[model samples]
Target: MSRPERWIRLRGKPRGPRAFRRDLAETAPGLGAGDLTALLAADGDEILGWGLYHPSSQVAWRELRRGPEPPDEEWVRAAARAAAERRRRSPEIDERLCRVVHAEGDDLPALVVDRYGDLLAVELFSTAALPLARLALPELHEALGTRHHRLALDAAAARAEGEAAWVETSPGCPELVQVEEDGIRFEIDLRRGHKTGFFLDQRENRARLRRQVAAVEEAEVLDVCCYSGGFALAAAAAGAAAVTAVDLDEEALAMARRNANLNRSRSIRFVQADAFGYLRTLAANGRSFDFVVLDPPKFVPSRRERERGLARYHDLNKLALPLVRPGGLLLTCSCSGLLSALEFQERVRQAARRAGRTARLERLTGAGPDHPVRLDFPEGAYLKALWLRIT
Candidate 1:
């Protein structure tokens, strides 16, 4: 089949880097365009760079490789080599927890790469980056000189980008590796674990937990819904006498146990139970903690799920408030973009009231600096961290 074509025009703005768009004219042969609500480069064209276009997504296009000419096989090979070389240079991106390709950051639009020990995970969002990944990943393997690679797809980005359904995970490679976060070390298992094998985004939050725990001598700590034992590890490091982490996922609890061992400490306890169930149990047992960290996964996935998610959040906190000692701390976090900061705050307030407790806001925060939000895209501001003092 003959491919349709379109010229990509570059639009430069004063505030930031320029954007690439479809010009519709100066067409090229054997290049299919337009039928795709989004456009992904299929053939060669004498353009400024190798572009991957997605008209359907919030981000229309991303220029992967920059040049005044079309990207050839040699260009793809060199890109593969350079990406591997860049990954090799970073002490963080070794056989442990590290992000390899971060979409626009790595010059691959809508693509994410994670390194899990000897395993490599790749997530493709754009159609152009998808097929291109299928082609270039082999080259990436050759460049890395490794036979084992695990390509995991993040379907969330694909759905948001308006692409067709894609498979999720592939074969596994390794079991465990030592990972460091904010000077704290953790043991992570890539084969059966969470995103890229660990939640690296919570690095800053863990540091905050450590700081808070250190302020209270031998404070009893509760790390609720603690995935991989991040906050618990931080609390233990901060000199907390006893730290209890609760999560339903057995795999996560296993890794958390390993992470605790890596810290050369066994002062923390792990419980594989539902978050809300454990919270209610603690309340029933008349147990109170000096610090509680409520870091749950995305409860609100879409607009329709917002109301129910908010109710759930409130209910969870309502049960948790009584478990917090008076004048103690409660660190609550919501990564759901659908749950705005104001909405989350209101829910927490309602929870405190229901528990017959008075709470004061101590701090408010968001994701780390690496996950930058665009000026216009407020929805990009997903993670909301709230520190509260219950009295």
Candidate 2:
């Protein structure tokens, strides 16, 4: 059945591709809940795009498609197919585990799809994309060659849309699935894991760390906030003399230990403690590492949290800097979308000054190639990692 369309007129000059939230002058009269509205120009009836109207959300309308034509299941399927094809063509992407659809990167706003071996994990960032995601799933399965799937709603989207946050689409799917990346093995818990079972975006970064450490024998390593020990395992596999992985989550520590055992990486010591306090203890103990990785969770979730987030980043780096031996490598990362790469680098500079050390930036990078960014939307490039060498 064809979907019904409602019309809404914009108030001012047309904004380029954007997420609309109460910026419009007027909405269609008598537009009820669940109406999929087409945005029109203020002066004429020329259609701009299609979006779903939610009266309760600050985002009054969440755009789904851009152009004059109305949106349908076929359009959704085409987007899924295109996203899959792009990933297939990327040499850096491992077909067994990688991102297939990266929300706005694929021009399919608010929907992300990742492949974990035979299992597919889907995430909806907004309620507006829920119906479209459901329509696109069959095509996604065909393109990615997977029938096992899981759907998860962004926590904020769940509250805004008033719907369940998670659902398992395929029965008989295993709770834990093992995936291999760059000759390293990991067991991901699809039902209860961070961001689509694993942090596949850092796949390349971990490999880079391994390659760098492989050249140095008996290198001491530290992985702060290392959920499931991705970097810890990589460093250990590269023949690090000793590796310490720290996180507050006991469940994650347990999994990290299990992963180390799985890979026969006995050098890693899993520690359950707050990262900040642990870093302080390491400094007070006069312990230093040849290499350190700081991959903390998102501190600045929204624009309002920017100031406090920068302070936290500054303090973390200040404590982390003294622990890096002279000429050692420090891989610091920030996943906060509100924090730009320039701002992050500035904060690190401030930390180095406070630590009375000079540092040179070796490399600056973001997520793996699978997580492509749109030219118009720089916010899509959220993950920032700086490889710094202390002097």
Candidate 3:
């Protein structure tokens, strides 16, 4: 992207550049970029940074780099190497599978890097991340020592640019690449799954759930929307007496079944059904569980859908809470970045009240250490999880 450097003045952002989509809703002074190319070359007078400049995107100019020194090929190489080295050394992160670069969290915005066995599945969340990816991927590949690189673009972000949603430039990933992350064995199809194939973000949470399951005797664990059986398999691995995993997607259930088989977990009963309907049926049949996990997909992707999404969460949790036996544990989660921790907890509190259950809030966790968040980018702190106990 050989484009002319544009100089712009930004104010009120003492922490860093405003890059998140949520920032767009604020009446805060907005900065517009020229339609020169996908990759942006710009100067904040003193700050020299490179970002993705999109005309139609929610955050049109999403800055990826910001520093006193101008970012270049060599600079990106060093940054990528450092980011990879950090993950490699983190005890919390599994070398077999982990997030090396968490966009802005790693001081590299717009770009995302995930490791899947011998290959690195690199995806640009938006075309805005492309400029940095172009400069960083080759260097990142060398740092990670991967056999191959699988490049993919975010379809939703691409569509905003009036481009095809699914765009891949590299070779397909190995089928069912097995990853033993955080002491749990998961066989995943990097080419077929969502967000670099597996939910590496839930690594530590799953491990925590496994330990919790182990502490209880004959724990009847219920995993809702058990995609590929991440949580269900974890519970089963911990020797839970009975584990019930449910999902609406047949393909996901099929994968979950395969994962159960791979883990040699025969205790889990896999069911393909609507999550709400299944929860309702479980409650109707008077079935209760020692531990229940509610990890649904993103409901509030943007500010416009905030209230509607919150209602969905409230309804889902209201139905699921009753199935949580008295004194049992419940883990509810929301991937919607727009829903703050306070907002999520309040919704759960409301749900518990509506369900006529006295729930004690035990913990509020988030994506594992692998998915780090920058202090300024509260939006980066997307995943909100609540650990509660029915009293």
Against the true structure, whose lDDT is highest? Answer: 2
Please name the candidate that would achieve the greatest TM-score relative to the true structure: 2
Q: Which stretches of candidate 1 lie over 4 Å from their true place?
A: 1-109, 114-121, 125-128, 131-149, 155-175
- Candidates sorted by lDDT, descending order? 2, 3, 1
Encode model 2's per-residue lDDT on 9-128: one tens digit a residue: 667755545535556777767775446788777777778788777665555665667877777778778888888888888876787799988987887777888899888888887766
Off by over 4 Å in 2: 1-5, 8-16, 30-35, 42-44, 160-164
Question: Each candidate: what lDDT?
Answer: 0.69, 0.84, 0.77
Between prediction 1 and prediction 2, the one with superior lDDT is 2
Residues 1-391, candidate 3: write the lDDT tens digits: 3323443333334345444443332211333432221222223234445454554566655555664444656766787888888888888777658888888887666678888877777887776566567777777777777776667887766776676766454575465577776566777776567777788888778988999999999999999999989999889889899999999988788888888887788999999899999999998999999999999989897778888999999999999999998899999999998789999999999999999999898888888777888887798999988999897
**Of candidates 2 and 1, the better by TM-score:** 2
Model 3: CA > 4 A from native: 1-5, 8-16, 19-50, 67-69, 169-173
Q: Which pairs of residues clash in candidate 2, taking residues 3 or more apart in a chain or in different chains? A: none
Candidate 2 structure lDDT: 0.84
lDDT accuracy of residue 383 in candidate 1: 82
Candidate 1, residue 178: lDDT: 68
Superposed by TM-score, candidate 3 places the C-alpha of residue 133 at a distance from the truth, in angstroms, of 1.8
What is the lDDT, from 0 to 100, of the residue 177 in candidate 1?
63
